[model samples]
Target chain A: MQIYLPIAELPISIFLVLGIGAAVGFISGMFGVGGGFLMTPLLIFIGIPPAVAVATETAQIAASSMTGAIAYWRRRALDFKLGGVLLAGGVVGTVLGVAFFNAMRRLGQLDLVITLSYITLLGSVGGLMLTESLKAMLSARKGISAPLGRAGHPWYFGLPLRMRFNRSKLYVSVLPLLFLAILIGFAGAVLGIGGGFLMVPALIYLFRVPTAVVVGTSLFQILFTMLAAIMLHAATNQSVDIILAMLLVFGGVFGAQFGARAGQNIRGDHFRLLLALIVLAVGVRFASEIVLRPDELFSLGLIEIRR
Target chain B: MRRAALALLACWWAAAARAETMVLSLSSHRVQITSTYTGAELVIFGVIDNERRSVTRQEPYDVVVTAAGPRASTVVRQKVRLGPIWMNLAQRKFADVPTTLAQISSRPIVQIASPDLRRRFGLGLDSILDPAGYDLIYDPTFRTALIRLQREAGLYRSEERGVTFITPSIFRAVVPVPATAPLGGYDVDVALFSGGVLLAREDTNFEVTKVGFEQAVAQAARQHPIWYGAATALMSVAFGWLATVIFRRD
Candidate 1:
């Protein structure tokens, strides 16, 4: 069935949107990551306005992470101290991201920026994840244990404002952690991604946070950051479509449950490998869109110059 | 409600200044767009009273009905190839351009009247979009691009023989309004022609508006941005919590 989206001012097939949401939600649940990285681009491909797609996907991620944060909390896996420091920095990043979004739109370069960011970030993340997961799977087959965290001290260890996080058992400068979170929050707000996929790896490899606490800490930071993003996009850009978000949430929630169950049967390395491939596939698709010549070279728009 | 169906608003300037008179009525004066609204059609039917004894030329009266939605400033951008990537580099902005423009006539617009008359009266989409009040014509590149894009979007259209004549005096036309049409008052201007001469003309307008849930949602987003944003956040969070509780994988 077709339904008119009020804020987006467009008509779209309701079933298609739900289907996309379901597929992405299943991935999110299976991987224990926010599906924003996959969803925002899919929505754009299906002809939703880029601004609306980005903002609405954040709402869906917010919903997914809310449940995730709570689950980790009850299991005593969440690191509140680490999460709090990240949240403090995340707020600042969210504001800056939205401001940047508004300025790009004013310059009529928002689409270019969105495409560029997707290509660069997704390509790098996908490539890194693929190599790392493949190495882990290979080492496991040979019955070799995974190496310890890192051989030498990282450069970030010497930064100012050093603090201890007991939950992750780390004593490092809060500066790098805060900076990592700010980047994650900014990506979440502007790209409509959960940033968990990126954050989990960063926390493990860069900050040397425990793998057990990575998912929970990332979820905590994403939930609030996406919340702020949804509100800011609504207040400033008026791009958040509540009805669109609700439709996605319904499909995503159910898909996630089934996905989580399905994920339980897969090995850790195998699951990561699969997720990595999907991420790279999406990144490649975006790359092709940018490089390939389009059928139409002219685009039309209403310049609502809010003077 | 689908339509207001207001009573006929007859000719504003007809018969008094010319030999013939015309009266027009729309199937609906207002269209209410609810959630289920896909698209709608506005019916324009009218009659010509040329039976006056003094009126002699009655070869065949031709009706040209042009409907234009409220004017708004718009921009059309062209993408230039920058190495391997193509990006929008050149843009032309048109001020006071009709959001939607449709011309429906009994026959081809070109065959209806002289080029001078068509240009003067703004009879077709091309005529209506023609930049005015300058000895130098605006760049044809931008103008053609605007028409091409708008036509692709179903915003600007021209349909010869869209208007049908039931009798020698009565004619009817249907203007298809796509759901993507911008919300605003749409002006319908009709001009009557006979034997390559302008006989009578009349113009009236109607409105397209969102009603019910659609209206409420659109209004909330624009008027209470902060509240709307907060409510959206609250809803998503609650839904997430609910999903976790219901599923309970852990």
Candidate 2:
């Protein structure tokens, strides 16, 4: 089936788009990542305009995060106090990111910035995940329980404006949490991500939150952050493609539902390793495009019609 | 120039002999862009009334048909290697360039007209790009890139010797409009050339417009962006809720 995207002014295969959404959604649900690291790049590979892909993907992320956050809310696993503080910083970061995005777009350098950021982010995160998961898998096979590592460094705890988050059983400084949230928030807004991969690790390692509560807290913060991004892109840039967003949301919501059940049957360490491999593969492919010469060195864009 | 003048005089005499100079029609004048619009082809056919002229040994009349979509500004960006990566370094803006262009002729355009004539009529792809209208500096690569990219995208085409003559005075050509072609008024120009000179010319209009659901959606997205944005967010959230409801039953 062929569907015409109004904003992008192009016709795309309906089934192809649905399949991409489902695949990314399944991976995100199974691994507890937001999947934007994979989804935004895939959308661009399939010829969706970069601006539309970024804005529309953010809209879809907002929808998917809402579903995940609700499930965690029902389970009483979300740390509202920590999530709220992160969101406060996230709002400020999103505004700055939007301005930066607009500036890059005007200079015709937005595509370069987006590709470079993805390459940097996915490369480091995927590499770390692969090593950590491999060690965990090896330890499990040897029938040895690995002791829980210390969550935070002394400097992170020494920051001012300390607050107690009873839900995670941690008393952490608000400054570090706010600073981390701002950084992730900027990344989420610019990269069209929910920042789950970055947030989950930060929550567990930097703030010393319980691993059990990290996924829920990350999803809660991501929901609000992506919601703000969607509105900003729509109102300011008018780049969000509703048709594209709806198709992705439809496939993503259903895929995540099925994926969650499939996740229950798999070993945690094995799935983590698999997801890490996929992330690293995507990052490598992105990097190769930059390091390699393009088939066509020149490109054209229709002048933006401002009414 | 002398030959062109004689050809014009002959065409005037032929027109004086008959009431009709030429008759032109298209397969479709209004192209409706529905949800299933993949592409379209217009069969441009015309009849030349050469009734008064003797059917003796003479040069066969050549047909050249050109179609251009609505004009708009376009920007072409050239990438330069900067350190480790290639980035957009310079941009050239072109004004009044057609979003889509298709030209079909009975013979190779070069054979039918001289370089000056081709440029004057905007016949061949190379010379059709108006040099005076672009930015201050004249770079041949930018012009070539613009046409090359558009052609690759199926928005521009030049099909030499594509027109066929079924009868002595009737000719037809098929012009293809790609799926990505913009929606607007398309101008089709048909010219009859004899002895390498233009004899008779006719102009027709082809309209491509969005209809039904496609029109409504495109209009709302452009005109009422705030409402459209709110609706998109709401719909996405609803989809998520619907999925949760369906799956939670398990």
| Number of colliding residue pairs in model 2 | 0
Candidate 2 C-alpha lDDT tens digits along B121-149: 67777766866323356668998999999
Worst 10 residues of 2 chain A by lDDT: A145-154
Q: Give candidate 1 misplaced runs (Cα > 4 Å).
A: A146-149, A305-307, B1-17, B133-138
The window of 10 residues in a row where model 2 chain B has the poorest summed lDDT is B13-22
Query: What's the true lDDT of residue B24 in model 1?
Result: 95
Q: Which DockQ values do the candidates obtain, in the order shown?
A: 0.50, 0.50
Cα lDDT, model 2, residue A128: 88
Give per-residue lDDT, candidate 2, residue B183.
83
Best by DockQ: 1
Candidate 2 docking class: medium
